[model samples]
Target chain A: MGDPQLSGEQVRQRALLRFDRVERAVHWLNASLFLILVLTGAALYFTPLIALVGRRRLIEQVHLYVGLALPLPLLLGLAGSWGRGLRRDVGRINRWTEADMRWLRGLVDNAAGRRPSAPRPRLGKFNAGQKLNAAFVAGGGLVMLGTGALLRWYVPFPLSWRAGATFVHNWLAFMFVVVILGHIALALSDREALRSMLGGRISSAWAARHAPAWLEEASDQ
Target chain B: MTEHAGPADELPVRGAGAEQPVPSPAGDGTQEPWSKPIGRRTVLSVLGLGALGTLFGSHLQSGISSALNAVHANGIASLLPGGGQFTIYTVTSGYPAAPADYTLRVGGLVQRPLSLPLAELQALPATRLTRNFQCVTGWEVADVHWVGVRLVDLAAHAGVNPAATAFQFRSFDGIYTESLTIQQAHQTGAIVAYSMLGAPVTREHGGPVRLYVPSMFGYKSIKWLSAIDLVARPQPGYWEQNGYPIDAWISGHPPVQAA
Candidate 1:
């Protein structure tokens, strides 16, 4: 039963809104900040780039300020709209059930494009892979904050502890970069997925193929 | 796929039919847009890029390092602290002067107490040591060549007292002081520095004669010239009194490395 459409104002209303404005804002803001921290942290770890980065003291001061401010964007996102927007997404990212393990089983194949015809399990809001990535990023952020604080001499820890912190900070940051690059590569490969992240709408066909459960749930809401 | 091909279609994620698979694209997945998985080809491609990155990165690094080395060839960075100009860390309003009446008295528990004017101090044979100078506050200046009488040599001239175990070094500024144990005082790089880079050490750099201890942190290298009094025990340095370690290493590494 097709009703007579109001033709003047509406263009196309059929697309799904996969991400709201607040969710996109938080994701991008966190991404950009983390990226800068990663670059500067890498420069510090490497001896070869010291001169290219210039004025070790000045560059280090910049690194310290950015590292300290890392949590501000996330906190603002959570509190800006009284925890309705970003906090909900965070919940979605953190939730895990037994079904997620089944989703995980196919991740390697999915990434490698080995099994194209297999039915993607009903992944709600986020797949198990995304959940794991989110959890890893959250845990990584805490380690960086703690270890960074100690290295910067916020409180007087022993020299040994400072050295230990330095070691952890370097290794964790390297692993983080490798993982983030993989995340970026996957997102860029899937056109609709990247579009959903940007303007928060994805074609229903892409939704059916990848995230059927999420599409069903959104339609009900 | 060729470089000119539409970037997004490099490794098509969804091929046309359900029954048959598409031919995998040859060559490093880096050339292709993202549909390439973490397969053998992809792994090798990343390693290839890493090797190339190392080659390119080292090329850039060497250019910068060599230029830096040329600019700072003769232990000059040390004399010109803070990358060219000296960094002042004095507590007093101004640096103390070495009035021509200036004499460094070596008087504590020594058999021969010698007071030498600056000119007389200059007459002694000079020994130069170029080493990396590091501060406890986490700054470093490399290749500082200091020309001065070794403290051990001076100790030999004055005949150090049998029981004396440490030397308390006083700065001309009076407020700053540091100490070195007998072993540290006799270490290879310990000196009463009077000249830097073939010139008389400037007042900005803690001279008439400042002590240079390459192994210990810069704080122990007490700038400004004055007196050395032998004592029986270790006294906390000015910075040490304010939470700095007695064993500050320039490398920010271990004390053993200083050895």
Candidate 2:
């Protein structure tokens, strides 16, 4: 569309940087670890899956280790001078402005097939939806880590606490599966967003349309 | 390059100026922790911290375990670790079987040594016990109906010598063995169980007979019952040799923490 003859390097030159290499690396690492955790967790939790994958002890160990490792990527990404992009992005995700509230309302209207009001607010590097997803991943990851650790090495706690942890961990895991599926569906529908996550770049034209506020800010800088 | 906020390369500029020194985000900077050169003192400190952490963890676990010993949170038994079904702990590749000419030996410190066939063992005065079959490692099958000859009746039939103070039980499996105090063996609830779950015990369950010590943990109820040797002193059997308690009583401590 924007000059078909453009080489990969030429396109990359014209593209806006959305995620840096460290951010993308962290994202992919987290995705891979989460996938392993989900598979191993399913094998451990479900009787049919347990029967299908008969090495229960091995699966249990893998689940424990993978779950423990889930937070490592984020922690590593948020560390050192190389983590500047991740740190800034995390800050952006935490702060909600008036434009974000407007974007959230627009999301509801967009879902209902109703056109947004005139002069709709421009979204930042991450839209309200993306910010909410990021918050959930961060908060939910911590909750899961605490509960899972308790379940794995529960000798330090009373039977009652262990039982509560089991309840929280199991239910939260199911919830995570549902939420992650929806996240994947949303990413898939937005080709540019998905591409940006993979290649660390998005077309200027795409950024202007989807994240005009972020594009304007970048231009101002 | 104008389309991007930072430089076109991988690293992004976050501060007011591209040349500005980047501050540490969360004190997780490489300059302090990861990038530091390893020294002997640092290594020793880390090792010492690790040892302290391990000791603290173990002490905390034991303290919690002791404090919660009386806390019978039985309502959530199924959710407890290894709480549900019976997990078979077999050492042999295949279950050992009693020969067609199998005779359970009732000897050693008895007035008269008697070797009786399965039919003869079954014909002895039977006692049916309905009790929870508790495993040492936090599991119990409740209200299991076990039909077999009482150990007291068997001891009476063989005329156990008054000098005898304990019984050493040997499994037909050859490798497996167990022992119980004579007083525990003479409990009304204990039996030489021949039938379980409304059927004759399967080989998986150590048939055609197994001891069911209802008052103690499942490990105390030795399987593949083949011989009973009366002795003067209580002897630790196979599991006891492997650090399992000699008296795995299901009381005072809960079934889940029986071990």
Looking at candidate 2 chain B, the ten consecutive residues that score lowest on lDDT are B31-40
lDDT of 2 by residue, A1-221 (tens): 33223334543356788999999999999999999998987766554455456454467668889888888887787767898788777655555545566788887889999998634765557676776666566656766776677656654554445444554465467778988999999899999889999999888677666766566556555
Which candidate tops lDDT?
Answer: 2
lDDT of 1 by residue, B36-154 (tens): 22222332343344334322432433344455466776764333212322234444444556776889888787899989888888788778888766544333455777889888778
* TM-score, A chain, model 2: 0.90
Off by over 4 Å in 1: A1-13, A80-82, A108-119, B1-259
> What would you estimate as the lDDT of candidate 2?
0.66
Two-chain complex of model 1, DockQ on C-alpha atoms against the true structure: 0.05
CAPRI tier for the interface of model 1: incorrect
Model 2 per-residue lDDT tens digits across residues B11-67: 222211221123445675432211111112232343344333333433443343334
C-alpha lDDT (0 to 100) for residue B6 of candidate 1? 30
How many clashes (backbone atoms < 3 Å, residues ≥3 apart in a chain or on different chains) does model 2 have? Answer: 0
Model 2: CAPRI class? incorrect
Off by over 4 Å in 2: A1-13, A109-119, B1-259
Inter-residue clash pairs, candidate 2: none
